[model samples]
Target: MTGARMRVALSARGVEVDDGAGGVLAPWGDVDRVTAFALGTVRYVSFDLVNGHSVEVDDGAPEWDEMVAALPAHVDGGVDDLPAALAALAHDDPVLVVGAPVLPR
Candidate 1:
């Protein structure tokens, strides 16, 4: 999705991304995995759905910081080193923030 105009947040049901006109609502149960990373000056969070689709949002999103802070509480098996990875703006290797290391398809 477009980065700057996006608004990502953790709703009571799951993750929501509003892009002004319309948005996507990925319910918690539909999410099979999650990842986070940073590249240049942008930090990203990706939600991988059980249906094999995905949604990604970046630091440009309005509620990005809030979504990142609330991730550990909402997701299971999230990596503890997320803060470190996100701080490394020069790197882009995605860090697992939820679900198993190897997803079961």
Candidate 2:
């Protein structure tokens, strides 16, 4: 069966900070902050079907409820349906993608 999947890249850059000893800056210092980025394909499941319903597995899937709950109350079954579903899933789990980047504030 076809399903939603995304191929993403997670990148992190260290932040520069003071040495506190009042010494010269170095190339690699303590990492106070971090920046990340996610780049890749974002495929979503096709919500539209000719008399077909989406199937979801519950066993071995702890976040099933959250994922389903994320769906919109009323699905239009249009081109944006998939995107809406993906957005819902993202809301439930920010890092839903396998290689989704995690950025630090």
Candidate 3:
């Protein structure tokens, strides 16, 4: 039998470094939101169900604000981009949430 490799969840809290032309990038800053690994200001994990897909994000609110504050410059994104209580099985997993309030087409 072929054994499947285990995948550790990538919980890198960040903000959307947008191009300002309507595109964005990452590491606005990465954060840890495992609750137990309370390394930064991780507020409530934001989650949303859109287009039949469920997405959760952590944006340092009530707690996560510190992570967002440390950045030199960043844009505010919705529940999906915060990278909070969210989970992704693999790289190929569908990213239902992208920008703030913008759902996958």
Off by over 4 Å in 3: 1-73, 85-89, 100-105
Of candidates 2 and 1, the better by TM-score:
1
Candidate 3: tens digits of C-alpha lDDT, residues 1-105: 001221112223333322334533223133211121121332223232233322233432233344333222233344333443233323344443233322113
Pull out the clashing pairs in model 2.
none
Instruction: Identify the runs in model 1 with alpha carbons over 4 angstroms from their true place.
Output: 89-97, 100-105
lDDT of 1 by residue, 1-105 (tens): 536776777766777878878987878878888877666777777888889987887777667677767776676664675556566645646564655223223
Off by over 4 Å in 2: 1-48, 51-54, 73-105
| RMSD values, in order shown | 4.4, 18.3, 14.4
Q: Please say which candidate is ahead in TM-score: 1 or 3.
A: 1
Candidate 2, residue 24: how far the Cα is off, in Å: 52
Order by TM-score, highest first: 1, 3, 2
Evaluate all candidate structures by whole-model CA lDDT and list the values in order: 0.69, 0.27, 0.29
lDDT of 2 at 96: 31
On TM-score, the leading prediction is: 1
